[model samples]
Target: MVLAAASHALSYFQAVVIGLLQGVTELFPISSLGHSVVIPKLLGWDSLAKAQSQSESFYLAFLVALHVGTAIALLVYFRKEWYGIIGGFFTSIAKRRIETPDERLAWLLVVATIPAGITGLLLEHELRTVFAKPLAAAVFLMVNGLMLLAGDRYRRRAEVRELVRTHASTESETEVGRRLDTLDFKESVAVGVAQIGALFAGISRSGITMIAGLARGLDHEDAARFSFLLATPIIFGAGLIKLPDLFGHLGNGVRGQSLVGAIAAAVAAYVAVRFLMSFFETRTLWPFGIYCLAFGGLCTLLFI
Candidate 1:
């Protein structure tokens, strides 16, 4: 039987708004999951929120669809990188060695993804029962702001120290930016471990991973690149895992809205990635940090 009917249909406008919100926030170091949970409550969509609270599978499957849309956007935008990684994956198997930088980077992403996969498999259901609530997610969103600020400040200090050391050394001394391919296995593992934190509703996958990258000495732009690249497989894989359940919840009435939402999510994600690739080159995460603090605080006040 159909598990349970939603009390009301999700309107097209609401679908679009939620899709845009999810897509943009997914890449922007804000928590997409947090927004999805909180926005419905804030908008007074009582039936939807009640349904979500009642049927975790329904809401989770909807989120999975949104994530799949974002993943598709990432795949299209980063097609070149994906090509290299795929080639490297096969070449390493043939050669019996991870020879190329691309191959090593590919392996590194695999290593980094392990913790999240394991953590999710073990803890996802349990955590969702507690942390997926609007009030709890809102509280964690503010905590996310603090994490961003701390990461940015740490990176700045590290950079300054590096600059001073460079100045003290010979004029011909070389400096290396921590490019994705250059990350040591241990460092990659550290980043992967950090990704476990993102399983919580308000902790952003990109935000935490990039924080770990910055902590490991990557420049802002490169950190963002690695973060986005690392995100593709996880998001896509999660969506794929949840897809069957998502379809189960769909009917003639709800399926169209879901498709519309997915398309809107794809468009928004593409724009977000394009804008952020440029923005991080010259900008810092401080603005995002501030925004999270303000927005999270407002949500907390309203919800609590």
Candidate 2:
């Protein structure tokens, strides 16, 4: 269905709500895509839900715009880091060697982004077609929660063992970055491969990536930082690829709504990332895990 015919279906209030949700959940390990699919259904916005399920629809275009906003927020938040990383990337190319931490990290992120980028290019449409429904999303959300819980448990155990063996204390930001920089290319590839799971509606890109990072011996804060860094390119690329939809016939009626939603998303994303960076500094993923489990379970029962 053309968005113009049903433009009124998505009111400004819904736009704001969904924008805020996208911003927050995109950063949180709670499966933003899953929530985007399920929440509309829960709210009885059948038109919006139906639009989301379609391969080419205004809702999907709107979502792409939201992703752009989220990506911008990440870019702004990590502006300093990006400046160094981008410079390091060029420097490494000029020198034909990777010696600095920023150079290594720049290369590492490239390696880690490849698998998911290729996978998304190859199978994104097929995967979304098969699993974008509320039922599938709900199931995957539960699985995501389980994965988070398992990852958290494993991290705790690993931390305890390390503490007993070496009495290491909490890691500062610099220490965390240094540790992340130490990751070999193989480990970076592993983290990247884990991101493939997020192609399914209910699996979180950040959540799965962070879990993989944790498995590679990164603490919570470091894992989160790496996940955010990795997400920046992917999110922006995806949005950029589909950005024409916002200006084409698909966006004919919803352009204004998209703009409003994008603004809300940007603001919400900045705040959410700020909060999460601080939260992860001294926290574990247990709370998010529990929240996902409970919410996913409840949604599953209600949907069924």
Candidate 3:
């Protein structure tokens, strides 16, 4: 049976807005999930918000489309890196030993992806059912802000800055995959484990993963690269699993809207990733942290 009320047909405009929001926020170290939940409520789109709270709602199916678009954008943006990584993965499997920097980085990504992949498989539904509400998401968004702030603060510690400065001066021109390959298996696992925190409605996968990478001594550029690389598979897999929903009864009335949304999401995501790669080259996470705090605080107050 269709879970979403028949009256709640998703409009094209809303689809575009939500899709753009998903694309940008998914990469910006701000919680895309949080924004998706909170924005509709703030706009008084009660039907859309109500649909999201339903387990088998059409909104959930729509989200699958958005995720697929975002994933595609990420894949395209990092095509060169992914090409090397995939080739390296297969070559290592054939050789039965990792030899190259690409091979090591590919395996490192697999190791780091395990914890979040497993956790998401088990807990994603339950967590969304329990805490996907606007009020709950707003609260968690504030917490996410604090996490980002803490990560930035940690990066600014005197010793940490000195260490990064020395490391950067020597390895400034190194390839990102090679730089990421320097992380040991244990550090990769730690970074992967940090992704679990993003299972919460307002916690950002990119934000927390980047924080973990920074904690492990990666510069902002490499940290962002790693976070995006790790997220590509996770996001794509999650969406692919639910892709059927978009073609089933759940998508009956919103197929056109979903298509438009997906395209908008793809465009927005490509632009966002391109901008962020440049932004992080010389910038820190302080701006994002502050934005999250302000936005989350305002939303929390409004919802309450």
Candidate 4:
């Protein structure tokens, strides 16, 4: 399906380009696939011209390549976690043991992935339409920027409330801060539900979901860890569902483009995964979100 098409279509240079996009955008608050759609749409003179009369389908296969590449990146980055999860699931089943934190976290990821899974099932076609037009994706990228800003704002507000609670209990003027893990499952579910919106809007899956985690009081690192882990199952599931049709409409240059794009995506996505986790430890998401805004706004001004 999509994986096969993506595998078949890849070329050397295109792989690097699309892989870079997939890797970078996937980690940053800006959507990688969103950029994959928008960049070509707005900057592609010939393609844009063709769309004046009707949309072309040139990028669909590219999109599939990026997704497959991303899926591979995710699997590789999180392999250790997956091993623990798989082992824990089987151990729990055979021995009726749920002692390990990994088992519980594994269950949590399952719960978290459900909202997006259901949402995608219901709205996938409509969501695909959004990517068919580059300008629209650019506009949505702007909206994603707002989402990040709003997420940071809300998270800070929640922190304030937590501080008040902390102060009421503590007698000392200065104390170490509580980590994000102190938050409850309710917060995780809230974040999971928020992820559903990403179905229609060009919202970053990581951005919205991470915001949801932050809203529930998870620290940036923990929130991000959970975000990447939660994302895999859903994205992988979507790829599986689309596997069939990837062959039917095979684009003109799919084979070569896919090869280049996939390699790029793999290398880039690998770097992005490594880079972003480190970045989340110290930096705020404001910068990434604002970047999305600038790009989105630029696309709008230039095109419309």
- Per-model lDDT: 0.80, 0.87, 0.88, 0.67
Top-scoring candidate (lDDT): 3
TM-score of each: 0.90, 0.94, 0.93, 0.81
After best superposition, candidate 1 residue 146: deviation in angstroms?
A: 0.5
Better of 3 and 4 by TM-score: 3
Clashes of each: 0, 0, 0, 20
| Comparing 2 and 4 on lDDT, the stronger one | 2
Residue-by-residue lDDT tens digits, candidate 3, 125-229: 999988889999999999999999999778767766555554423244432212566788998999999999998989999999999988777878889999999
- After the best TM-score superposition of candidate 3, give how far the Cα of residue 245 lies from its true spot, in angstroms: 1.1
Clashing pairs in 1: none
Per-residue lDDT of model 2, residues 95-136, tens digit only:
999999899999999999999999999999888888999988
lDDT of 4 at 26: 73
Candidate 1 off by > 4 Å: 1-7, 51-57, 159-176, 249-252
What TM-score quantifies how close candidate 1 is to the native fold?
0.90
- The predicted structure with the larger lDDT, 1 or 3, is 3
Judge candidate 1 against the unseen true structure and give its global Cα lDDT, from 0 to 1.
Answer: 0.80
lDDT of 2 at 194: 98
Q: Candidate 4 — worst ten consecutive residues by lDDT sum?
A: 168-177
Task: Give candidate 4's root-mean-square deviation (CA, Å).
Answer: 5.1
